[model samples]
Target: MRLFIQLLGRFGVRLDGEEVPSIAWKRDRAAALIKLLAVSPQHRIHREQIMEAFWPDQDVELAGANLRKAIHFARRAMGTQDLITVTREIVAFADEVQLETDMERFEAAATQALRSGDPAECEAAADLYGGILLPDDRFLEWLDAPRERLQQLYAAVLRKGRLWRRLIALDPTDEEAQRALMQAALDAGNRGEAIRQFDQLRERLHAELGVGPSKASIELYERALALSGAEPASPAERIRASLAWALVHLQSGEFDKAAELARETRAQALGGGLAREVGEAGAVLGLTAHMQGRWPELFRSEFTEWVRSRDEFVPSVFDGHLCLAEFCLCDAKGHAAIARSAQELMCVAEDADSVAGRALAGLILGEIARCAGDLEEAETHLNEAERLHAGANALSGRVLVLERLAEIALARGQKWQASRLVQRALGDATQSWLSNHLLLRLQALAVRAATTPEKVEEAILTGDRLLTPGACQPCSMGLRIASAVALTQAGEMEQVDRRLNEAERIAGMWQGGPWAAALWEARGIQRQAQSNKVRALAAFAEAAARYEDLGRPLDQSRCLERMAAVMPAAGA
Candidate 1:
């Protein structure tokens, strides 16, 4: 009977026609032993050598017994008693055992195919080659060199086959068995498969490897789809198509239209009752609302509803947690509520191994600390967030963390460090409009540290850019107040009053928050600089009142100190 050994795909072994799935084979020890024999030009291995190769650590007696057991299993699996003829002295394949391994067939076929110039032959060689031999079984040191050589040969054969397929497919007379073979070649990576087949392959590949198809394969398949005039019906395509329309509206700053399309996609996902899809769509909608400054609509209701509906919605938790963090920081009544929400989010993130979740949790902790006037603790948490963001390749997360760090640095009088961090934050915040406000505020602080008049003017210009009509309210207020401060320093009294009035009006609309307190304090400082003692005192008192109302006791005390500096000691 004919006997053979071959590698299945890359990591499996087959003896004759039977497969040996387990590494601990009772048969000829699969290719590992055969490989030892094949490499020994003498076509025979001394019993001691075979024992030493496989069971180097075992005693001679036990090793010999294991080798004999392997030989017995191999012979039985091969169905040929004479396949591996072994004596008491040595082991070798019988003369009747004609080895027909795929590697040998593939190499021989590849040489002939290259000489014949036949596309079909080239494709046949490629089909036989499959992938590298025993790629994942690296514990076998003897297989590595030969495996690498076979891999190179296989890659060459595949390249030749790919070229032949394209050439033959372009020529009608040449496209016979060549076309079918070429299709199979392209189908190795499932590149030329129909959309349904491709999707199936994608799902299978992801299940097996924990990754999607290579980018090259996906691009090639997309081109093939265009050639065949068949639209891909994959879920990725559906998601991308809807996302593209939503982004188009988003880019045009049409929040309503963006929100509508995003909502429709989210509803569709929810209707399908797929938790992952619902979470993905809900995240997109929540992000859209954040950019549109419609936080209440997205977080308080829409996001909460989505979170309550989905059982395994991870992204929804992140979105809801972030929204609550922002709400707590912006709303005096929401601090404890936000902290509770953040704790819940951290639990979910730790459970899911989510890097983004951990980073956001750190940021939330920092916000809580900052709100409590624990600047040192706030900086520590923000630093932790930055470190996590850096390790996880989360650019936007890093940007937010850096922005918070800059704010703390400025508060601590580390102006130079704050300036550098603010610049980095601005560059990273390019994708998020909400961050632009922060960028503007940082630029103003940097300018305050600059000794040159040019720097002050540049800061004023930055403030003007941030004060555009559609700017986010908090960001615009920050810029307006900063502009007032910059104008006062430039000795432009008229422009300072104009900017201060605008800032006060914007603050009135903004009610109480960290931003409102800052603006009021900025106006008071400008009045003090202008020698308007009464106005300065009144402005400082108003700022102190606003800070006290926002639960910022430290800021309230600082405002009172500034007021005392400007006013006389009445009772004393």
Candidate 2:
């Protein structure tokens, strides 16, 4: 009898290679009891201890009965009493029951990798221990010991090497932890983070330890500075090092670098026959492509391929489902089909116990509804996504939800609400490239609410600052449209024409898509302002056609209305 427990995403217990779904869904006590036993070092646990641990508030006899029921349910779920045998002396997991626990596997793998001097393996192993142990079972005494151990171990690993930055991110004041991270940053040649960590540690040590950093820490800092003297060393030291680098780059608005690193990481993982690594790399690549306005490439390279691939690999199946939903949201080629695809993706994501995945799926569903002109459905899904993000403390997810809400408000002509929502989004954009890009688009919408030329000019300047030359085409097009619109409102007809022409030229060089439709719509406005009714009509028609093709019925209708108003006789 082999007992397998996976707490990677949500939680699950399996016996003999078969997952016990009912234990996960219907019996909380059984699930909790199994988790407690699996995490315990002593496979044998006393019945008194179980009763006291779980039901300290209740009568001893009642607690004992409840424990028995839970044990019975657990045995039923396991489908064999051979795995868990009970005696009056004590209850113990059978030795024949070889337990496979993620926590144990992760710790063993990380320790072995560190001992063997395999940084990539160590990093991968560390990533497996993403959250602290039994994060959801915090109140249970049985879970506390293992959770603390895992937390300390994770902190130690972070301090030793920056395999997982999120550990330090939770508690920056841990000096010993900071020291470990400093060493890791130095080892990886990330001069910026290394220096940053050194300074932080110096301050923390002075405040907490009443002394400078340790000799070993100072030596590492000095070495890092020396290495950074001529040129910054490679961003990362190992193959799996790219994950940390990708996060850094993603936060720094270096989408191209993030995409390139993700691609390299995927190729390396595929070469190494690491299916999970390949899937993670592919997901990162797909996300980078989507953020960089390369949705077509994302769908073709990752989303389509993963969905068609075999499900023997868990990571591939999970990533494939997530990518499918994201692709459905962005791909403009088939709205109905993509919407159905997103629904299916949601089911898979839920099955995987992926909170982030489900939140993202809901967001994509909202986007699909928004594109199809179903603002009510869009709002429902967006609200659900927002709720999930809040529950999970997912900053990126919240940003996405807010941006979509702002777009919906703008489409509905709720200018004041749109402006307020966009302002909130701007405040929350932080350092993420996607958030910043969304902020710029929201600012463009807010410009419509500007009552004065000065305010319009301010919005234009804000939009201009966001359209840095290497930024995503979608973001650039948004800024161009906003600038053109603001200039037109300010009675700067000549400047409007110039900006519109530039936007048109850029859009022409790019392939036709939803982004291009925005640029063309801006050009249509400029033509209408110039009294070139024929060209204005043509431009609006083209913009509408593109929007319709992208499944954005609301935008298409807006373009059609503009064209109809301009060419009343034509009645487009």
Clashing pairs in 1: 27-73, 27-74, 28-74
CA-lDDT, candidates in order: 0.60, 0.65
Q: List, residue by residue over 289-364, the lDDT tens digit for candidate 2.
A: 6667775445534433443343233334234224233333454567676667667767765666555556666877
Please provide TM-scores, in order, for all candidate models, with all chains considered together.
0.48, 0.49
How far residue 221's Cα lies from its native spot in candidate 1, in Å, is 27
Of candidate 2, the 10-residue stretch with the lowest lDDT total is 317-326
The parts of candidate 2 lying over 4 Å away from their true place are 1-284, 287-331, 431-436, 449-452, 568-572
- Over 1-572, each residue of candidate 1 has an lDDT whose tens digit, in order, gives 44455553553445555665554453326545666776454568898878777766568888878787787776565455677877767788887666666667787888888777677888777677655465433325556577777666655554566654433222212323233443564556443453444444433332222223444334444544554434454555455345445655665677688768877876666566544445445545665676666654445454234334442443333432332234334345456676676676666667766665667667777877776678988899889888877676555557768867876776677877877887777766664322444455555666655546777766666555454334445445555666667667676544565566666776686554566677778878887876778888888998898887776667788899998888773323
Clashing pairs in 2: 159-180, 159-181
Tell me the TM-score of model 2: 0.49
